[model samples]
Target chain A: AQRVTQPEKLLSVFKGAPVELKCNYSYSGSPELFWYVQYSRQRLQLLLRHISRESIKGFTADLNKGETSFHLKKPFAQEEDSAMYYCALKKAGSARQLTFGSGTQLTVLP
Target chain B: NAGVTQTPKFRVLKTGQSMTLLCAQDMNHEYMYWYRQDPGMGLRLIHYSVGEGTTAKGEVPDGYNVSRLKKQNFLLGLESAAPSQTSVYFCASSLRGTSGVAGELFFGEGSRLTVL
Candidate 1:
């Protein structure tokens, strides 16, 4: 069994401040991690995957094997960045199945 | 392109009533999934299909059933509605599953179901 945990239920930050959404995972085998976002009145979309090692909308996440963590970070928060974010994990050889975390609602205030 | 579309955007059902949520994808995906979202639980997979004729149970498949008679369509059925079944259902699809690659999911707008 695999599990993904997003510790924070809600995170609020002032515009231009740095923000981080913490995620942890428990999986026996090597795992694939991803971050997904859902904006108000919009469908959930993929923000980025760990393997991509690329930033999207100024947000980046680094998967740490030793600590079993994948934290999403943004250098400077923007108002438009406010949204619900989910951290998900897929065990190796598990097909396309994904186990999602409870999610964190990020609010960027002006 | 209507990547993934779920029918009956919103529905209300009483106890013992039956309903089926239809999901269709036009992206020619090989994998489709049905998940229910609650206030704090995020998304729990109810059922999934890897291809046209095969369906598999997911984490929360006890109260639901699924069918995948066609490659592009996956249907989720609730034989008897329960209060606990009220939730926002999401349909998603991905091209294919490889060993190390976690295929990104394309999701539908979602279907809100209320059981009274």
Candidate 2:
């Protein structure tokens, strides 16, 4: 039984300020984590993944195995960054299905 | 390339009525998935298919059914519509093989469904 949790349902940040969306997961085996973003009037897309270790749109997330967390972070917020962010987890060798979190609605205020 | 396309972008149905949502991918992906997005609940996997003619239950599979008769098409069916089933549905596809396990998923614009 694996689960992903995004504690904050909504988060607001001023333009140019740093932003952090918290995410935690409960999985005993090794896990692959990813952050998916949905922009206004757009389809959901992958923002970043722990395995790739590459940042997209200036956002990055580090997987913390000890704490069972994979929080998404950005150095500075922009109005265009406002969207729904979901944290997902995939078990190492399961059915290749991802378990998603409740999601965080990030609003970057200008 | 019309990466992933879902037909009937918007649909309204009455309780007890049934309908099917169609998803087609042109990328030749061997894996397809159906998910429902609700406010605050994020996107929950309803069902998924590993390849043609193979389907499996996902996180929230109780109220929905799915089929993957064709390699490029995955269909989600609702036997009886209910208000609780109203949500935005998304279809996604990914490659298969060693790189498929943790590959990125390409998604469709999504289908909005409302059960009255």
Candidate 3:
């Protein structure tokens, strides 16, 4: 079975400050990781995936195999960044299915 | 395109009552999933279908049943609703399982169910 752990339940930061949302996973085989975000009154949507290796809305994540982590980071925080973020993992197998973390509520204060 | 749409956006049910939630996707994706979201529990998969005419159990499936009779639609049924079943249900779809692991999910607006 695959599992994802997002250590922080809530993270608050001041505008212009750097922020990081930590995430860890445990899977026997190679895993695929992704970040999904939900804004107020909106549907959950994909933020980014490890394979893409691209940044969305100034947020980026690097999958660390040795440490078993895939933390999301942003150089500077913006108030508009406030939302709930979830980290998910999919293991390699014929029935590979997604496993999501508890989620972290990020608050970017002015 | 109506990427993903869930019917009965909000519902209130009584214990022992039955209800069914409908999910439809216009994307022609081959994978559809039903998940329930609670305060601190995040998203827990209730049921999923890899394709039409097939459905499988997910993380939390004991209290739920699913049917995927059509390629573009999936339905979740609760024979007897309970307090624990009151949650925000989300329906999502993706291209295909072999299309790779991180196939981004296109989710619906979600259905808020309250059982009292």
Question: Each candidate's TM vs. the true structure?
Answer: 0.98, 0.96, 0.96
- Candidate with better lDDT, 1 vs 3: 1
Tell me how candidate 2 scores on lDDT: 0.92
The fraction of reference interface contacts (C-alpha pairs within 8 A across chains A and B) present in each candidate is 0.76, 0.73, 0.58
Native contacts present in candidate 1, fraction = 0.76
C-alpha lDDT (0 to 100) for residue B70 of candidate 3? 99
For candidate 3 chain B, which ten residues in a row score worst on lDDT?
B95-104
lDDT of 3 by residue, B1-116 (tens): 98999999999999999999999999998889999999888899999999999999999999899999999999999999999899999999987656554568889999999999
TM-score of 3: 0.96
DockQ of 3: 0.69
iRMSD values, candidates in order: 0.6, 1.2, 1.5
lDDT of 2 by residue, A1-110 (tens): 98999999999999999999999999999998999998999989988889988888899999999999999999999999999999998888666688889999999999
Q: Candidate 1 docking category?
A: high
Question: Which scores higher on TM-score, 1 or 2?
Answer: 1
Candidate rank order under lDDT: 1, 2, 3
The candidate maximizing lDDT is: 1
Candidate 1 per-residue lDDT over residues A1-110, each given as its tens digit: 78888989999999999999999999888998999999999999999999889999999999999999999999999999999999999876676788999999999999
Best-performing candidate as measured by TM-score = 1
RMSD of each: 1.3, 1.3, 1.4
* TM-scores computed on chain B for all candidates: 0.95, 0.95, 0.95
Instruction: Give the per-residue Cα lDDT of candidate 1 at A73.
Output: 99
